[model samples]
Target chain A: MKLWHSFLKEMKLSARGFYFYVEILVAVIILVMILFVVPENFRSVEDEYLFYDWPEGVFEEFVLPTLMEDDLDGKIESVEVEGDDILYPAQLIESEGTRYYIFESEEAVLRLTDLDRPKIGAIIRMDEQSQPYYEYYLQGYETQRLRNVYSIFHILDFDLMEAEFESQEVRSLTDGYLELSDRENIVPAMLTFNGSMMGVFIIAAYIFLDKQSGIIKAYAITASSVWQYLMSKVLVVLVSTILSTVIIVVPIMRLQPNYGILFVLLLASGLFSSTLGLVVASFYRNMMQAFGILYFLMIGLMLPAIAYFTPSWNPAWVQWIPTYPLIQAFKETILVNGDIGYVAWVSLGFFIASGILFVFANARYKKTLVS
Target chain B: MIKVSNLYHSYNKDEHYAVKDVSFEVEEGEIFGFLGPSGAGKSTTQNIMTGLLQLQKGNVTVAGYDVKTISNKMFNQIGMSFEESNVYSKLSAKENLEFYRKLFDVETRDPMELLRLVGLHDKADIRAGEFSKGMKHRLTFARSMINNPTLWFLDEPTTGLDPAIASEIKGIIREQNKKGVTIFLTTHNMYIADELCDRVAFIVDGELLLIDSPRNLKLQYGDKLVEVEYIKEGETIKESFSTIQKEDLDKLQEVIGKYEIQTMHTKEATLEEIFIKVTGRELV
Candidate 1:
């Protein structure tokens, strides 16, 4: 009815097309709510393998035997612990004709007896590989008591007597990595796909709606200048883009509760991607032309959006592309740690350049309206 | 208030001038009609005068601002209702008026009062675009007065209206003229021009062939003498003479007194006939 009210009215009119996006977001949010609060939601984190720091030969000596690799091992005939846990270690000696072996958790080095020769090797859990000591009194011998005590790695503990072997004390610990050890390095790939690409669906939907409805010519006569109007539309599209980006990447970064940072990153990405859509949509007469141009433009975007599909594969010349700043900004703060200082400037640059692109798009599109 | 000199324009990207060598003046407080058939430069000339199109070779001054250099400020001083309906499709008739009411410096016009004036008050809540073409035209006519602009441009402003409604619009245009607003209208309806315009310009192929007050044009083109025919005893006789001449008036009285004068009256060419004779084209 009034100017501001009428502006809001037009905004509401324009927002009809956003219903599909709302549906998508509601569905995703429902899934996330179910998954987050619901138990045993197995989104099977892909199987992973990684190499870690270890003492020399420890992996082979301890780990290889558990894998069923046979090895000739000496017997622990005697043991001693003079000071503390290290006061005694079972001394190992090769057996002449006897054939038996022992490895166990929490056995004193001095208690082993009978000097049974190890068959080839005995499976000792990683937790019990070290010698134990108590009161500085220690000795070694073979024990026939097989008490099936399983340690952290689930390998059987064995107490064997050998003249040359050493005793050890090891409390089992659950093996875990502080930072997820990604041997295949999959995160950057996912980040790249999400960065400049998150707005593609919104862009496609926007052009299609405009084409289907006969509103484009009505837009041609608005009192607002072409640039301001286009920028406003970009702002509207950016709202959706930012919302979609947060919906997509927040849980991925495991930061559903981090609304502040999520908003910041989403706003940055939306401004960037919506501008990209505007620039691409400039050459289109309708929806089909928009998507056709989008594919070609994305090739250029992907070339520099290298950080998305292949971060390590970035060409030396990627920074020259227009989309590079947006990709760099999104990936730096959102995908990588919140490197806000580095990304903030890039985000600002993206916004300013996006503003310029909007002006250019307005000029280009105003010509199309006349046609 | 609206004047053009050697106005020339074409599609900026393409070949020829849509309006070529068009020049006219619409004096303040006059309804100057631009009459032409389709494909004539009537619309193009109107667009230039209204500052809707860029003039490459002409200087158009409306309400004292050059159409090119002062296009922005000039828009506020002008109100337009083109051949196409430009009202918002989603808004009711009342809502459409109110939407544009704030765009001008003038006091906001009461939407209800305006709709009632246009006989659209009963349909005030109906979407203006969904209304019949005649109703939309009336609403458009109402919309043009929203700004209370000093200069008004109406292009084929009453195309789809019934005769009764069309005459009502003509009356409203007269009222607007009496309020001292300059109206530059384009229409092919000679009845409209003959009834409403104080003066009219006949434009054809981007050229102004004739410009005069409609009353003056008809008087200039019509025969000055009156023709009469009467029936005698199984025979018919006719007489022709000027009414303005003193002796001719006395002879008409004598003839009526002498025999049964079946018909005796003055004759004048209609505006449509005059337009055809001047432009070699029918109004339709």
Candidate 2:
């Protein structure tokens, strides 16, 4: 009952300070940007592949057989001879109702390329070790996920040929990016970065304001425990995060994502961030003194967004950040073929982290709060 | 109601102590004033007794609870009005009191009643941030009484108020004491201490000089003297005569008989003078 009272007081305090209204404004702005400003599919229809082979028969030997083995059904319908002795004619390969133009050299590929088609070029080359490697030329408009898909496909093909293996089938871990549009794919990033993690900054600011106003000293002499005080602030932060999350998620995702799991993930993330803010706020006397640590932590939390947008750049350290799994969990809820087990594990980790941080924060506040 | 024995506190956790070997006790329903200048460790001692500061090297028991192991039940019986006005600026005066009243598990006084007691009944709806310093301090004082605490810690309650408001605050403190509340008032204001305290302790440089009733201290340390003003030879003359000195008393009588006396009054030593005499330091 005391916690509930404290929560109500906190809400009133936050509301009076215009924090509540500011969050609503932020949510509205983000919703408009996501729903209207961002395009549905960043990848255009002309964003097909154009294979370029350097030495005479690299495509015929390394690429053709791989495409045929994968049941790609690649067939050369016509070959246009350019009347050049050294360079072979461009071969038009058709498979699965799509056309792939294979060129002999870089110069010929550039010359024959249609300016209207926004094709991503795949240049094949032989390394000094006699192994085939690919260098992709991308159009400016392709998303990082699409670029990653191209790289992964070629790298796997070359690795298979070197291993003398016959595993031609490409198995995906999830239903893959095909299930989400470019605009929908960005929702998880926004939810984790702008929605759930809002608690870290907001809660720290609240603590600093209270400290400057000497409210914490007044509270220390009261009957309320430190945990109750911290939990009340955490609850306030969760309300803000939930408001922003619903505002962003409902319009774009609607019933597509599991509302229960999404809210659970948000709760975990919000609690974790709020407790972290409390622990950090306890060490410093005021916000100006704590700006260095706050900025560092905020930047560190945002590091995961880089890895989230670019799926192929998964460094070991970046993956170790707490927000990494949180963003991934948000994505899992939005997509149909998501890994529920992974989401469960990430949510558990967040909850445990929040518990440990809460303990540390509680101890710090109790010892140094009134000093 | 509050007891401290051999209390020592070091801000740096070293030998440089802010409070050293301090000990005192307040009886139930008594107003005990901790008198000291700035940085004299009066606040340190009070903080230790109220469980605001950790008991570094001594024992403290307030309302029968060890301060080192003070629980929520003890806090329910204790209220502290800080030196500065510490309140949520965004909350109204009534809201601030209401918010704090809910923190206690015991039965609490109505917020409106407390506000009215502090003479802030009409400004109850005003935000604390917009309040003047004295108004905020009054609000803080009112908040301290919301829990109906038996053991109240008041730090400089009337330090910066005007004469009228200060007098009102002193009256409220007196009224609360009459209701059997034990007040641990810490301040450097000697006049307030002399007027409101049942007993005042003089402390300086992290050490207590003496603790006694105001009348007892005055009688022990003050000189017995009288100042006389009279017209002699068409000229007003002023003189002081020591009551203990026979020759001075004789001269005073002769002057009184010879010239029409304008005024004569016994001079009593103030608490400020006694404080300086006892501690050899002036209260700021």
Candidate 3:
């Protein structure tokens, strides 16, 4: 009965600080930024479904003219205006039915040829009387490719990325640019990863307030042992992590909706990162110091990618750091298109180990520094 | 109920002992006061007795339990209140009381009664963080009594408060004593110690200087003489008589019979004077 009373006391403290709310906000902000914003910027143009037509009796029919059409009826992926000066529409790449008009930008030049101007008139009689331009024009109709809807289901069986493309097979739609699209999706994921680290520090620092106010000691003085105190802290952190996941992961999941594996990853990764944060919080006297260390760790986490892609193997041991497990979990679950179950368990183990270490460290703090 | 012998403790051991060879004893159901200056090892001795610290070479026993054998049950048997309030600041007074009440297995009284005793019933649900120092001390007193402990240890129990409030706290301590609780008190405030303690001990520089009941010490050291003044034949006259002297009794009889004896009373020693006489110096 007393134990129940103590738990209520703890929940009261947690509720007052709204520690869980901050994490939920983190998750919401990240998922929204990724699924809502990044996709709009990088959407493939070919995902548009449109029908084209022209006056069959015009002196000249234009080869192609694109129109603007979006899910919201705003920025069409590609639009071509034809007149005395005719503009050829650029081709698009479609992923999950979202089309991005690659708009002949510098980056597009290296990835694609000048959106092959259709050679329809090359073998025919549509003349440059059309080249005189205004009266005669060439016309053709095509719509963007349909989004590869099945890519969502194949996310866990990531070998589809390397497997041969077989268009006759229902699963083959997950191949080709679909695989690259997920990797490209990771850029904003990196940014949100930064924001989540901020969330970890913001919430983890609250433990220091508990330490200073002697509430932790009050908890310690009870039949509540060291492990229980540590667990209470871990539970708060776990909630925060979940909220962050909801804010960041859910929306992204909605866009390239994972088949529940992402949820498992979200939970497992949240637990791991939160535990790592607790370990960081254990060593510092205050939140500002904890944040400084978190900033350093965030930088170190990104260091391996430099080596992950660089020629020298980057010779950096970034993956060996404590924060590496959660970052790697994100990469494996999201970017590398790997098995979510494998990464989830690995993340859980890391979380358990770090949590145990954090508990031991806090117990030591109580024993030595608390007085 | 509590005993200590040859207790030596040092914070910076290489420099000096905070408490050196301190020895004393408190009979069961007795109030024992420890009077000393700041840094004179009063608190160090108390902490060691409470098992918050390990004694270097002394055998200290509390409530028939060896001090070294500190178990969870022992904490329930003894209650302690420090000079500096250690109650949870953020929690309401009732919540703070509730939290400490669970630290032991003993069945405690209702915290509401404690609130009433400390004169804090109205503030029971108020946050302790906003309370003044005196209010916090009152809440701490309430917390100390929650477990209904047999051995009560209060360090500077009434260091702050208006006189009425301080007296109210003393009344509560007296009430606890009536119930046969052994209170081991430590304070530099001689007046509180004198009025409250059944037997008091003075210590200086970690050494015990004296121990006795307040009344007995005052009687032993105070001048046992009565001074009187009278106006006779339009002349003012004054005389002092030894109250303890046998021959002076007749002189007092004649003076009271023939002339009005103007204000005659026994001389008295204050607790401060007794402390100074015993320790050979003023309090810090």
Give all candidates' CA lDDT scores. Answer: 0.61, 0.85, 0.64
> Candidate 1: DockQ?
0.08
Between candidates 1 and 3, name the one with more favorable TM-score.
Answer: 3
Ten consecutive residues with minimal summed lDDT in candidate 1 chain B? B68-77
TM-score of predicted chain B, candidate 1 = 0.90
Whose DockQ is higher: candidate 1's or candidate 2's?
Answer: 2
Distance from true location, Cα of A288 in model 1, Å? 6.9
Residue-level lDDT of model 2, residues B51-165, one tens digit each, is 6677889889899999888798888998889899998888899999989888998999999999888899999999999999999999999999989999889999997899999
Error of 2 at A56 (Å): 24
List, residue by residue over B1-284, the lDDT tens digit for candidate 1.
Answer: 98799887777645576777888888998889888888778987876665445567878888998867643446566777757665665678887787667545455468888899889999999876579878887887787777677888888877888888877888888888999999988999888888888888888777788899988998899878888897767678998988788998898878787777777678888888898888898865
Winner of 1 and 2 under lDDT: 2
Q: What is the per-residue lDDT of model 3 for residues A1-371, given as tens digits with 9 covering 90 to 100?
A: 55455556666666666555655565565556556565544544332222222235431234322222224444334565232354545444344545533333322322222233421111112344432211111223422221232224333444565464543466553333144354344533452364345535654666677766545543443333455555555555555555555555445544553436555655555555556666677677677667677888767666655544453453446656544455555555554445566666765776576667666665555443334
lDDT of 1 by residue, A105-211 (tens): 22432233212122122322223445321121112232323222212223324434332246555443433212222311232233333434546545545544553
TM-score of chain B of each: 0.90, 0.97, 0.93
- Which 10-residue window in model 1 chain A sums to the lowest lDDT? A44-53
Q: Judging by DockQ, tell me the better candidate of 2 and 3.
A: 2
* CAPRI tier of model 1: incorrect
Candidate 1 stretches greater than 4 Å from native = A1-6, A15-232, A242-307, A310-328, A361-371, B12-15, B223-230, B234-265
